[model samples]
Target: MNESTELGEDFKCKLPNVSMSTQSKTMPMIDLKVYIRVVAAVFSISSATALVMALLRLLTPNLFYVEPLDGSNIVLHYFITGLMVVTSAIGLLNSCVVMNRSAAKNTGRNITTWLLLDSLFETTRVVYVFICEVVIKGRGSLQTYEMLISIAQYLLDSFLYCQMILRH
Candidate 1:
Protein backbone atom coordinates (compact mmCIF):
# COMPACT_ATOMS: atom_id res chain seq x y z
CA MET A 1 0.00 0.00 0.00
CA ASN A 2 1.01 3.59 -0.55
CA GLU A 3 1.99 5.90 2.36
CA SER A 4 -1.34 7.74 2.31
CA THR A 5 -3.34 4.50 2.44
CA GLU A 6 -1.32 3.22 5.39
CA LEU A 7 -1.77 6.48 7.26
CA GLY A 8 -5.51 6.47 6.62
CA GLU A 9 -5.86 2.93 7.93
CA ASP A 10 -3.99 3.84 11.09
CA PHE A 11 -6.22 6.84 11.68
CA LYS A 12 -9.39 4.81 11.22
CA CYS A 13 -8.21 2.10 13.58
CA LYS A 14 -7.44 4.61 16.29
CA LEU A 15 -10.76 6.46 15.90
CA PRO A 16 -12.85 3.29 15.51
CA ASN A 17 -16.22 4.21 13.93
CA VAL A 18 -16.10 7.95 14.75
CA SER A 19 -16.07 10.52 11.96
CA MET A 20 -13.07 12.84 12.28
CA SER A 21 -14.89 15.83 10.79
CA THR A 22 -17.77 15.71 13.31
CA GLN A 23 -15.46 15.26 16.28
CA SER A 24 -13.36 18.18 15.19
CA LYS A 25 -16.39 20.47 15.06
CA THR A 26 -18.16 19.34 18.27
CA MET A 27 -15.32 18.83 20.75
CA PRO A 28 -14.08 22.39 20.52
CA MET A 29 -17.52 23.81 21.22
CA ILE A 30 -17.95 21.61 24.25
CA ASP A 31 -14.58 22.65 25.63
CA LEU A 32 -15.25 26.31 24.96
CA LYS A 33 -18.58 26.22 26.77
CA VAL A 34 -17.00 24.65 29.81
CA TYR A 35 -14.25 27.27 29.88
CA ILE A 36 -16.74 30.12 29.64
CA ARG A 37 -18.87 28.74 32.44
CA VAL A 38 -15.87 28.47 34.73
CA VAL A 39 -14.79 32.04 34.00
CA ALA A 40 -18.29 33.40 34.62
CA ALA A 41 -18.60 31.63 37.94
CA VAL A 42 -15.30 33.06 39.15
CA PHE A 43 -16.13 36.67 38.23
CA SER A 44 -19.66 36.34 39.58
CA ILE A 45 -18.33 35.30 42.98
CA SER A 46 -15.85 38.19 43.13
CA SER A 47 -18.50 40.75 42.19
CA ALA A 48 -20.92 39.39 44.77
CA THR A 49 -18.31 39.63 47.49
CA ALA A 50 -17.57 43.27 46.63
CA LEU A 51 -21.27 44.05 46.66
CA VAL A 52 -21.59 42.54 50.11
CA MET A 53 -18.71 44.61 51.45
CA ALA A 54 -20.18 47.78 50.00
CA LEU A 55 -23.54 47.01 51.57
CA LEU A 56 -21.91 46.51 54.92
CA ARG A 57 -20.09 49.82 54.64
CA LEU A 58 -23.31 51.60 53.70
CA LEU A 59 -25.32 50.13 56.51
CA THR A 60 -22.70 50.51 59.22
CA PRO A 61 -20.81 53.61 58.36
CA ASN A 62 -19.41 53.96 61.87
CA LEU A 63 -17.72 50.61 61.62
CA PHE A 64 -15.34 51.97 58.95
CA TYR A 65 -13.98 54.88 61.02
CA VAL A 66 -13.83 57.00 57.91
CA GLU A 67 -16.36 59.83 58.07
CA PRO A 68 -19.85 60.75 59.12
CA LEU A 69 -22.69 59.25 57.11
CA ASP A 70 -23.63 61.69 54.37
CA GLY A 71 -25.41 61.81 51.04
CA SER A 72 -22.31 62.24 48.88
CA ASN A 73 -20.50 59.37 50.52
CA ILE A 74 -23.52 57.12 50.09
CA VAL A 75 -23.88 58.02 46.45
CA LEU A 76 -20.22 57.55 45.64
CA HIS A 77 -20.04 54.26 47.49
CA TYR A 78 -23.05 52.85 45.69
CA PHE A 79 -21.88 54.13 42.35
CA ILE A 80 -18.41 52.63 42.54
CA THR A 81 -19.61 49.36 44.01
CA GLY A 82 -22.36 49.10 41.44
CA LEU A 83 -19.98 49.85 38.63
CA MET A 84 -17.65 47.10 39.77
CA VAL A 85 -20.45 44.57 39.90
CA VAL A 86 -21.94 45.60 36.57
CA THR A 87 -18.64 45.66 34.72
CA SER A 88 -17.66 42.24 36.01
CA ALA A 89 -21.05 40.78 35.06
CA ILE A 90 -20.89 42.28 31.60
CA GLY A 91 -17.39 40.95 31.08
CA LEU A 92 -18.48 37.46 32.08
CA LEU A 93 -21.49 37.55 29.79
CA ASN A 94 -19.43 38.79 26.90
CA SER A 95 -16.88 36.06 27.48
CA CYS A 96 -19.63 33.43 27.55
CA VAL A 97 -21.04 34.55 24.23
CA VAL A 98 -17.66 34.75 22.59
CA MET A 99 -16.52 31.37 23.87
CA ASN A 100 -19.80 29.74 22.96
CA ARG A 101 -19.14 30.67 19.37
CA SER A 102 -15.49 29.60 19.63
CA ALA A 103 -14.32 33.06 18.63
CA ALA A 104 -13.09 34.51 21.91
CA LYS A 105 -9.38 34.87 21.31
CA ASN A 106 -9.34 38.65 21.63
CA THR A 107 -12.46 38.79 23.80
CA GLY A 108 -10.81 36.79 26.56
CA ARG A 109 -7.80 39.07 26.50
CA ASN A 110 -10.00 42.14 26.72
CA ILE A 111 -11.90 40.73 29.65
CA THR A 112 -8.69 40.06 31.52
CA THR A 113 -7.47 43.56 30.83
CA TRP A 114 -10.73 45.08 32.05
CA LEU A 115 -10.64 43.11 35.25
CA LEU A 116 -7.09 44.26 35.95
CA LEU A 117 -8.05 47.85 35.29
CA ASP A 118 -10.99 47.62 37.68
CA SER A 119 -8.72 46.24 40.38
CA LEU A 120 -6.31 49.12 39.85
CA PHE A 121 -9.12 51.65 40.14
CA GLU A 122 -10.29 50.11 43.38
CA THR A 123 -6.78 50.29 44.72
CA THR A 124 -6.47 53.95 43.87
CA ARG A 125 -9.78 54.79 45.47
CA VAL A 126 -8.85 52.98 48.61
CA VAL A 127 -5.51 54.77 48.76
CA TYR A 128 -7.20 58.12 48.38
CA VAL A 129 -9.56 57.31 51.20
CA PHE A 130 -6.68 56.20 53.37
CA ILE A 131 -4.77 59.41 52.75
CA CYS A 132 -7.78 61.57 53.50
CA GLU A 133 -8.61 59.66 56.63
CA VAL A 134 -5.07 59.48 57.96
CA VAL A 135 -3.50 62.74 56.87
CA ILE A 136 -5.57 65.67 55.61
CA LYS A 137 -8.84 65.59 57.50
CA GLY A 138 -7.62 63.19 60.13
CA ARG A 139 -6.95 64.22 63.75
CA GLY A 140 -3.45 65.60 64.35
CA SER A 141 -0.77 64.58 61.84
CA LEU A 142 -1.17 60.78 61.44
CA GLN A 143 -1.72 57.79 63.63
CA THR A 144 0.77 54.97 63.34
CA TYR A 145 -2.05 52.45 63.41
CA GLU A 146 -3.88 54.09 60.55
CA MET A 147 -0.73 54.44 58.52
CA LEU A 148 0.03 50.73 58.91
CA ILE A 149 -3.45 49.74 57.84
CA SER A 150 -3.28 51.94 54.77
CA ILE A 151 0.09 50.58 53.82
CA ALA A 152 -1.20 47.03 54.17
CA GLN A 153 -4.13 47.76 51.93
CA TYR A 154 -1.83 49.26 49.34
CA LEU A 155 0.37 46.19 49.44
CA LEU A 156 -2.62 43.92 49.03
CA ASP A 157 -3.72 45.86 45.98
CA SER A 158 -0.31 45.66 44.44
CA PHE A 159 -0.17 41.90 44.96
CA LEU A 160 -3.62 41.46 43.42
CA TYR A 161 -2.70 43.43 40.31
CA CYS A 162 0.52 41.47 39.94
CA GLN A 163 -1.38 38.21 40.13
CA MET A 164 -3.85 39.38 37.55
CA ILE A 165 -1.10 40.30 35.11
CA LEU A 166 0.68 37.01 35.63
CA ARG A 167 -2.49 35.06 35.00
CA HIS A 168 -3.08 36.91 31.77
Candidate 2:
Protein backbone atom coordinates (compact mmCIF):
# COMPACT_ATOMS: atom_id res chain seq x y z
CA MET A 1 0.00 0.00 0.00
CA ASN A 2 2.85 2.44 0.78
CA GLU A 3 4.52 1.62 -2.57
CA SER A 4 1.25 2.37 -4.39
CA THR A 5 0.86 5.64 -2.43
CA GLU A 6 4.47 6.63 -3.31
CA LEU A 7 3.85 5.90 -6.99
CA GLY A 8 0.67 8.02 -6.95
CA GLU A 9 2.54 10.92 -5.28
CA ASP A 10 5.30 10.70 -7.95
CA PHE A 11 2.71 10.76 -10.71
CA LYS A 12 1.07 13.86 -9.20
CA CYS A 13 4.45 15.62 -8.88
CA LYS A 14 5.21 15.06 -12.58
CA LEU A 15 2.04 16.77 -13.77
CA PRO A 16 2.29 20.35 -15.12
CA ASN A 17 0.92 23.15 -12.97
CA VAL A 18 -2.25 24.62 -14.39
CA SER A 19 -4.82 26.96 -12.93
CA MET A 20 -7.85 28.93 -14.10
CA SER A 21 -5.77 32.04 -14.77
CA THR A 22 -3.12 30.16 -16.68
CA GLN A 23 -5.57 28.74 -19.16
CA SER A 24 -5.94 30.63 -22.46
CA LYS A 25 -8.87 32.96 -22.47
CA THR A 26 -11.06 33.68 -25.44
CA MET A 27 -9.95 36.95 -27.01
CA PRO A 28 -10.93 39.04 -29.98
CA MET A 29 -9.57 37.65 -33.23
CA ILE A 30 -8.42 41.02 -34.55
CA ASP A 31 -7.09 44.26 -33.09
CA LEU A 32 -9.66 46.99 -32.51
CA LYS A 33 -7.87 49.45 -34.78
CA VAL A 34 -7.62 46.95 -37.58
CA TYR A 35 -11.26 46.08 -37.16
CA ILE A 36 -12.24 49.74 -37.31
CA ARG A 37 -10.12 50.34 -40.39
CA VAL A 38 -11.52 47.30 -42.18
CA VAL A 39 -15.08 48.21 -41.30
CA ALA A 40 -14.45 51.78 -42.43
CA ALA A 41 -13.10 50.56 -45.73
CA VAL A 42 -16.20 48.43 -46.20
CA PHE A 43 -18.40 51.42 -45.43
CA SER A 44 -16.46 53.55 -47.91
CA ILE A 45 -16.83 50.99 -50.67
CA SER A 46 -20.54 50.59 -50.00
CA SER A 47 -21.07 54.34 -49.96
CA ALA A 48 -19.17 54.72 -53.21
CA THR A 49 -21.26 52.00 -54.80
CA ALA A 50 -24.47 53.65 -53.62
CA LEU A 51 -23.27 56.98 -54.95
CA VAL A 52 -22.50 55.47 -58.32
CA MET A 53 -25.90 53.78 -58.48
CA ALA A 54 -27.72 56.97 -57.59
CA LEU A 55 -25.71 58.98 -60.10
CA LEU A 56 -26.38 56.43 -62.77
CA ARG A 57 -30.09 56.51 -62.03
CA LEU A 58 -29.98 60.27 -62.19
CA LEU A 59 -27.74 60.92 -65.17
CA THR A 60 -28.42 57.88 -67.28
CA PRO A 61 -31.97 56.96 -66.46
CA ASN A 62 -32.22 54.78 -69.52
CA LEU A 63 -29.40 52.53 -68.37
CA PHE A 64 -30.07 52.29 -64.60
CA TYR A 65 -33.45 53.57 -63.64
CA VAL A 66 -35.77 52.53 -60.78
CA GLU A 67 -38.88 54.25 -61.86
CA PRO A 68 -40.66 56.37 -59.31
CA LEU A 69 -44.34 55.84 -58.41
CA ASP A 70 -45.59 59.06 -59.89
CA GLY A 71 -44.14 58.52 -63.34
CA SER A 72 -45.59 61.87 -64.44
CA ASN A 73 -43.61 63.79 -61.82
CA ILE A 74 -39.99 63.44 -62.79
CA VAL A 75 -39.07 66.15 -60.31
CA LEU A 76 -39.73 63.92 -57.28
CA HIS A 77 -37.70 61.13 -58.80
CA TYR A 78 -34.78 63.49 -59.35
CA PHE A 79 -35.17 64.83 -55.84
CA ILE A 80 -35.07 61.34 -54.28
CA THR A 81 -32.02 60.46 -56.35
CA GLY A 82 -30.41 63.69 -55.21
CA LEU A 83 -31.10 62.76 -51.60
CA MET A 84 -29.45 59.38 -52.10
CA VAL A 85 -26.39 61.05 -53.60
CA VAL A 86 -26.10 63.47 -50.68
CA THR A 87 -26.58 60.73 -48.07
CA SER A 88 -24.02 58.50 -49.77
CA ALA A 89 -21.55 61.40 -49.86
CA ILE A 90 -21.97 61.94 -46.15
CA GLY A 91 -21.46 58.24 -45.44
CA LEU A 92 -18.35 58.17 -47.62
CA LEU A 93 -16.92 61.21 -45.86
CA ASN A 94 -17.53 59.69 -42.45
CA SER A 95 -15.85 56.44 -43.49
CA CYS A 96 -12.83 58.32 -44.88
CA VAL A 97 -12.41 60.11 -41.57
CA VAL A 98 -12.50 56.80 -39.72
CA MET A 99 -10.00 55.16 -42.09
CA ASN A 100 -7.64 58.17 -41.98
CA ARG A 101 -7.67 58.18 -38.19
CA SER A 102 -6.26 54.65 -38.13
CA ALA A 103 -3.22 55.84 -40.08
CA ALA A 104 -2.83 58.95 -37.92
CA LYS A 105 -3.15 56.84 -34.77
CA ASN A 106 -5.87 59.14 -33.54
CA THR A 107 -8.82 57.56 -31.80
CA GLY A 108 -11.07 60.21 -30.36
CA ARG A 109 -14.61 60.54 -29.09
CA ASN A 110 -15.25 63.05 -31.85
CA ILE A 111 -14.83 60.41 -34.50
CA THR A 112 -17.22 58.10 -32.71
CA THR A 113 -19.65 60.98 -32.40
CA TRP A 114 -19.39 61.57 -36.12
CA LEU A 115 -20.01 57.90 -36.69
CA LEU A 116 -23.11 58.04 -34.53
CA LEU A 117 -24.43 61.03 -36.42
CA ASP A 118 -23.74 59.43 -39.76
CA SER A 119 -25.52 56.27 -38.73
CA LEU A 120 -28.52 58.24 -37.57
CA PHE A 121 -28.66 60.14 -40.82
CA GLU A 122 -28.33 56.95 -42.82
CA THR A 123 -31.17 55.31 -40.92
CA THR A 124 -33.32 58.39 -41.32
CA ARG A 125 -32.65 58.57 -45.04
CA VAL A 126 -33.56 54.93 -45.51
CA VAL A 127 -36.72 55.37 -43.46
CA TYR A 128 -37.71 58.39 -45.49
CA VAL A 129 -37.23 56.55 -48.73
CA PHE A 130 -39.25 53.64 -47.45
CA ILE A 131 -42.08 55.91 -46.41
CA CYS A 132 -42.07 57.94 -49.58
CA GLU A 133 -41.75 55.21 -52.13
CA VAL A 134 -43.30 52.18 -50.52
CA VAL A 135 -45.86 53.40 -48.01
CA ILE A 136 -47.12 56.66 -49.43
CA LYS A 137 -46.66 56.25 -53.15
CA GLY A 138 -47.28 52.46 -53.10
CA ARG A 139 -44.32 51.71 -55.33
CA GLY A 140 -42.51 49.06 -53.36
CA SER A 141 -42.19 46.46 -56.08
CA LEU A 142 -40.39 48.69 -58.55
CA GLN A 143 -37.52 49.45 -56.15
CA THR A 144 -37.70 46.36 -53.93
CA TYR A 145 -34.11 45.44 -54.66
CA GLU A 146 -32.77 48.90 -53.89
CA MET A 147 -34.90 49.22 -50.80
CA LEU A 148 -33.80 45.84 -49.44
CA ILE A 149 -30.15 46.67 -50.06
CA SER A 150 -30.55 50.02 -48.33
CA ILE A 151 -32.27 48.40 -45.34
CA ALA A 152 -29.54 45.79 -45.04
CA GLN A 153 -26.87 48.48 -45.25
CA TYR A 154 -28.57 50.44 -42.50
CA LEU A 155 -28.70 47.41 -40.21
CA LEU A 156 -25.06 46.53 -40.88
CA ASP A 157 -23.86 50.08 -40.38
CA SER A 158 -25.75 50.37 -37.13
CA PHE A 159 -24.27 47.12 -35.85
CA LEU A 160 -20.73 48.11 -36.87
CA TYR A 161 -21.11 51.54 -35.29
CA CYS A 162 -22.21 50.02 -32.02
CA GLN A 163 -19.30 47.62 -32.07
CA MET A 164 -16.89 50.46 -32.79
CA ILE A 165 -18.28 52.51 -29.95
CA LEU A 166 -17.99 49.63 -27.54
CA ARG A 167 -14.42 48.86 -28.60
CA HIS A 168 -13.43 52.49 -28.47
Worst window of 10 by summed lDDT in candidate 1: 134-143
How many steric overlaps does candidate 2 have?
Answer: 0
Query: Which regions of candidate 2 are displaced past 4 Å?
Result: 1-27, 60-73, 102-105, 135-142
Prediction 1 global C-alpha lDDT: 0.49
Per-residue lDDT of 17 in model 2: 66
Best by TM-score: 2
lDDT of 2 by residue, 73-143 (tens): 46665777788888888888888887887445546766666677577557646754664455445343435
- In angstroms, how far off is 39's CA in candidate 1? 7.5
lDDT agreement with native, every candidate: 0.49, 0.68
Alpha-carbon deviation at 138 in model 1, angstroms: 9.5
TM-score of 1: 0.35
- Clashing pairs in model 2, backbone N/Cα/C closer than 3 A: none
